[model samples]
Target chain A: MARIYNFSAGPSMLPEPVLQQAQQEMLDWRGSGMSVMEMSHRGPHFMAIAEQMKNDLIELLAVPANYRVLFLQAGASAQFAMIPQNILNGKTKACYVNTGAWSTAAIKEAGKYCEVQVAASGESTAFTTIPAYADWRVDPAAAYLHYTSNETIHGVEFNDIPDAGDLPLVCDMSSNILSRRVDIGHYGLIYAGAQKNMGPSGVTVVIVRDDLVGLEAKNTPAVFSYAQQAKADSMLNTPATYNWYLLGLTLQWLKGEGGVVAIEQRNIRKANKLYQAIDDSSLYRNPVDPACRSRMNVPFVLADATLDKAFLEQAEQQGLSTLAGHRSVGGMRASIYNAMPEAGVEALIEFMAEFERTH
Target chain B: MARIYNFSAGPSMLPEPVLQQAQQEMLDWRGSGMSVMEMSHRGPHFMAIAEQMKNDLIELLAVPANYRVLFLQAGASAQFAMIPQNILNGKTKACYVNTGAWSTAAIKEAGKYCEVQVAASGESTAFTTIPAYADWRVDPAAAYLHYTSNETIHGVEFNDIPDAGDLPLVCDMSSNILSRRVDIGHYGLIYAGAQKNMGPSGVTVVIVRDDLVGLEAKNTPAVFSYAQQAKADSMLNTPATYNWYLLGLTLQWLKGEGGVVAIEQRNIRKANKLYQAIDDSSLYRNPVDPACRSRMNVPFVLADATLDKAFLEQAEQQGLSTLAGHRSVGGMRASIYNAMPEAGVEALIEFMAEFERTH
Candidate 1:
């Protein structure tokens, strides 16, 4: 098989090893004579797989015992609605730090269930940098302070996790989850859609504080109820089983590759190489402040904007895919997620250098 | 790969051809060197697949242009909340015919958003039959009347579609979708989770009337808004691309096998054979009414209840799996879906007769 590098934002790239393992197990998973898709979610075989995934994740993230992990359908967008519905607790207000497109969406969804205050915002900077904590005004009695840890679209990140004082902190880490080490004890909730850095598009991993479990409003459907889903071990309704299985494969890969600490070093190296190239080059520049710039999504623009199309086309011919910036804010973005090998970054850097020399 | 029969009710059996095609295309989908799951939902490749799925479904169902198709996530269960959110249109009430588990769930979720009237119910018979249309007491002013066309758990089906008498009709055809022909014009909405007879669990197909597009409640999330999804051509968010691809393959298979008309006759034959054998046997009994018995799932109980355990264990050892009925109502269930060849059903019947004779 030919080596291919995919740079999609989500449903993006998976580890080649995971894909190979999946293909091998596609028809008969571990001698079960059934594809993981065909296994009964309730059967012992599937239950074991689900348990192993949850266990591996707990180990990978060092998830505290007081937190509940839920493998749910619908992506991080669903959690936008689910978070408030579960944690509103009759509180009329919630604090949100707007960092990028995803946090903006989270704030919008939170607004429906509670009064959301923009405690801090990176919007004024075109989402190129995280707002300083000194500028934030968090309410003492607010239910929780919501934030997006990594913004896939704008390529902005909070290098330092926010301090919410005593208020619970909810983070949407969809784009950069498991790429680095974090103190799981610090935040009240951490949710990441699996598409970008984890496994696939269908499942969202939600880790919530145990005390926050059963606070769903009267109208909450059983399917969306945190308490209900948690009690059911995220098998509340037949989960995206195949996706769960793939996640298990990815988690195993992460473990075999020396876990989060080892992976983070690789991620840092990859991001630093690309960012250094952009910072040192005259033809391209990344606008975000170096301190808060994302290590996952690197959004940069060409000095001569007219050359953008030609650059993208040339990049595509060389097999560099999905380097186009989000249409919401156009330029170019190269998402160097955990699944993206160091060699891919080296190749991208080589290509950029060659393109600049020619153009 | 070893051949096996999967008897799961939802996330159920897929066509062998579909699975084979998927396996063959796992590493390189159409020479693109990207699995369908790895493709960007927005890209040309995925857009083509999405459009083709819609076109094929329209062709299969003969759906009129006036009805818009939205491929959504979160399963049929999500539609439970979505229906009242979109269709209520300020109407105070919605009429729901309680057939079995799925309909009951829809009514429960709908109750949160609108006044839900039990227009008719099969609960009196433990959901063993579809409620007769003559017995219905629909609210003329209700926004829409909902029913489950086929109850997977109860093994009951509506042999005839109901007339809503000017009110819009909504059917949860999760278990019976694409098994037979239907007049799509009569429905305001037809939603089915694509796990049962369709493809996978993540993608839910909702065929809604064009007029029913723009009435989401002010609080409805953009992702769940039918009107919003329709405008985006079901690329509202990164959808279950692999699942959608599989659905297109199933639709292609249906078309190749002479479409729904041909499948329906075969289903009828399969159902008749299995039901007839149960009726003839002194040792077995299926409680559903003759007019309402499902062609998809046939739940039967042994007359000698003591042998039920032995029968299931022996059946499993022989590679006949998931014969145990739903926990809600337990005995034995043989789900003869479109993918279940007649030979499998015949083999099951032969095993049943042998077990009965030996006992």
Candidate 2:
């Protein structure tokens, strides 16, 4: 069987070229006589690989000179706890926007370390729309303001960065990071798991401004301390060597496809086509607000719930894999990240149309 | 270039068969039309892979029914903190044995969470030998007893498990796990980073007894909480999926190579031959006590300090790579984990003899 377009919410599709490069180097990486997985993290061979990866990511994101990029483990989920641990900075409270599942999770974790002020919530609208920023009641004494840039499960995304006044703005960009260009200067910190837009799972990329690097709470694990990790260049301990290599390969591939700017254009085209098909049909309807629907993960439901099983079965047969939405929201979701090509989205559209016509 | 013998301390060599299998399935895994890296961790394909890998490890270790094996991220470095956080069980003090560099580091991290009581110290002997059990000061009031089974940097290993008596026994087996057989029933928890005897660097394996599962200190990150993560089957977050697959492949390869018993025999033979060669040579010497010298990492120094650079250069030219000792204790170190074949060890011994004859 040939490669199929994997629509998994995460650990999803990767570009063919990146996989090919990794496959080619599986036995010996660039004549070094060791696979990337086999290299010592501190040795010259792996050091060079690590340096190039960090520099490439900084360049691609146009990260500011005052910021540090760290390649970490445990994904964005770790950052939920790390955010308050590193930057609460003796403050007693933190403000969080409750957008969807990811946001709610971050808020719950933050509650463990500090008083959590739910500045605003989309739950009132069933998480289908972003709450109006004007209605948010952020506490002036809050240490930081946090929000999920793109909710992977609810399919909601913030179109613009929210102002945090004097507090540092933190964002979880796990699902839509490299797919679009953003000014890194806008946030105090940005973190994303590599599984989605970057590469595979294991590595989490954290971009933090200078001021937010230090000031970790007492008893914070060294691995989760942004200040300690940044000083060591994210090699404070043995890193995920092979995952870093794969991430570097993916970033290089993204550059060859013309960096984030070019990929954003492709992503918009793909998302628009799929959403257009959904809106144009009576059988299928997307519940998310038109303005804030996630371009990375597009979730929709069929008019008749009985067709969900048949729709998924036929999609799998056609090589359209993992189209089922999250169990919490039972329908279908097409996660077309940067690695997901326009052709894959078109394939989904065509299949949906044919299924609607038949049923 | 063909694969060379890699002797790095931790992120070391993997079996070639495992790499070959991973490469063969890089693009599409067993006709799934998707790479293993691209599969949803919750999907049927990945669930099957995860199950098989866990069962194989359990079978290879002959793990008792009362233990839970977790595939986690952040390596054993994170476990340094997690062990204290999860099992302090309201006790203020925990006993720790300081054998070498790894034990020292673990003690440092554990101190942040609990009152650390030094049970024994090999430091007085420059970490070259383990202290006698009768001389160890076991604290009856302590929550647990922590010891590093093998020290990669100091080239020291414990020949047998230390009795913790009433306290739960925790062992950091990062560098030598699966290279020897051990009774799982003896331990309350056994943790290891996967870079050495396992597979790669991203995943950390934690095998914990059922009795030690729940008790977590307040503010422990949910991902690091044994009770929470065990309930979620270690998928508390998006795990290092590809790393888990690689680990599984490595475990399968180990099973084919006759499991831990067979590998232990090979490891002992490899260590003995390497040690005999060093002892026979006038130019080289191993400082560790013969009774407790590691059967995994063999750290040695040349009689002539000036020959260090030349030794490394010439060794590299002979395709013997990463033989440099850890920076903290410089000379030369050969980490011959379970994946290293007898032929590779023979090649190293032959090279050393030739180098000694000339210089």
Candidate 3:
């Protein structure tokens, strides 16, 4: 069976190899006589899988020795509350840069625990661009400065880390994590929901600097406490064992495919090809500023809005799927995460051109 | 490949049929051209799977119309905090029945959010027996009376729901949910981590009565708020797509196995046969009171403690694996959840008899 190019923003595609490996081992993982799903998290087999997953992620990202890596659950949405809970310490206020839907979500959850101050926002531009860092009114006294590295909905990406100086820099990299090389040292904390580039939709990864670990707001749920999870080696309770192992397989695949550096180059090429095709087209338009457009999620509108339905219906008939935009907004979105090959991007471009010529 | 009689508690085992079905659908789900892992949670396919899963669970549990079903993440551990966060509405205190490890955890997390009153505890008897509800110091003024339906670590099960007349009855049925039929109308809320008696680890199920749904405490994380989750149909974030689909398969398998009533009969036979074997043995002992013994996780100690390692090793050689008891209190634990067939339990009994005779 031919697999279609899956472009869903998240719960997106995993490498075919990863899915195959998981399928082959669905009943017995490495002859353990039990499915990975049935293995105890504290058992040696799962523990090894968990350890290897952490080590590989650390190696891939070159995470500093002082950072604590945790495989958590709930998702990045939980991190919206957890980051402020764990990082706010004694500070009653935090600074945020709002770029799009996700950044807005972070601000909303952060408001639950502390005074969230938006240092800058792109709402004035309908989330079409990120405000220049020079224009950001960052507060040095705030607990930390938070930003979403890539806004999945608006298709805005931060090309460079925004400077937070003395305040810790926290980022929501859910849509773009591991798609590119990152300097882990620049952020006090980093988190991503594993549905996108990581693996599937169960495990959530959090990388928190050591010094930023212990402090938690009163009444922080134990599941949301980095210090508690770190102390327990993230086995604060039963983990999503199967998802963890699937993620491990994805990490292994990523490494076998030449690690994050090679993946980043491929991601750049795929994004460039798609963006170039859109820019050259008379029938399609992307509203986000080119300088800050996401290399992960590309939202574009058909020149004739009336043709949108027919375009999507035909795309599916031709084995391209999930290219529809997030329902909150109206245009079409193509999310080419790490697992999406440049060939998929090329196919999408070819489809666009053919559909336009025929019209 | 021949499968083993896996006895690991929690993340323990799944029905052979469920595993086989999942393997068959691992790459492409029903000609969808993508793994369920790659599907968007909001898409029609996954939405149907989610709806079917909920219906099966409701039919199997006889869930009342006034109750709401939610698929959540993190785990039962997250519910330890969330239960109080959502249930403690205007009430300054809550009642708890502490039976074992999970019960103790619930009390601890609840303490973080409210004034917890231990109505009854098994600590006086080393958690080997459930205290009678008549002996409980239950407070009618408390918002809720919470308990673990089965103490997984202690091999104790509350044979009857504890009486909590005016107060809401909240239960954590993580290890035993769906193993037996439950009267949903009796419970204000019931939660289970879906690793045992359901499908795999990752997704959690919460069944909450309508009137008890909306009262989230201030600062409750949106991800932890059942009202918000129930409102959004639990897509407040990406639901654990693959795990969610796997659970759907398990529910389908459960229904095909004649639903919970039939499974409960099988479970009863399996538990009785094993318990009788242990009770009849000169070289084994089970500490939990027979009146409230668990039908799911049966913890036993060898008459000769020195032979524990030999037993586990030989059991592995015999394709009887993970029989070692929980480390906190160890000798042997044979978790015979619904997935554990009666034949497997008989095999364990035969193994116990043969080993006793040989030693």
Model 3 lDDT per residue over B1-359, tens place:
47788888979888888888888888888889888888988888789888988888888888889999999999999999898889888789999999999999899999988899999999999998888777999889999999999988898997777779889999999988988877878888999999888888998999999998889987889988988999999998888988888888888988999999899999999999999998998999999989989999999999889999999999989889888888889889999988887888989889889999999
For every model in order, the TM-score on chain A comes to 0.98, 0.99, 0.99
How would you encode candidate 1's per-residue C-alpha lDDT over B1-359 as one tens digit per residue? 36666666766677878777878888778867788888888888888988898899999999998989988877788889888888899888999999888888888889999899999998998998776688899989999999999988889999888999999999998889899889989899999888777776678899999989999887776778899889988876777777788889989988988899999999999999999999999999999999889999999999888898999889877778888899999899998888888888888889989998999
Off by over 4 Å in 1: none
Query: What is the lDDT, from 0 to 100, of the residue A177 in candidate 2?
Result: 93
A102 Cα displacement, candidate 1 (Å): 1.6
TM-score of 3: 0.99
Clashing residue pairs in candidate 1 are: none
Select the stronger candidate by lDDT from 2 and 3: 2
Q: What DockQ does predicted model 1 obtain? A: 0.55
> Which 10-residue span in candidate 3 chain B carries the lowest summed lDDT?
B1-10
State the DockQ of every prediction: 0.55, 0.88, 0.79
Per-residue lDDT of B90 in model 1: 85
Give stretches of model 2 more than 4 Å off: none
Q: Rank the candidates by lDDT, best first.
A: 2, 3, 1
Compared with the true structure, the alpha-carbon lDDT of candidate 2 equals 0.94
lDDT of 3 at B331: 85
Task: Report how far off residue A21 is in candidate 2 (Å).
Answer: 0.4
- Predicted complex 1: CAPRI docking category: medium
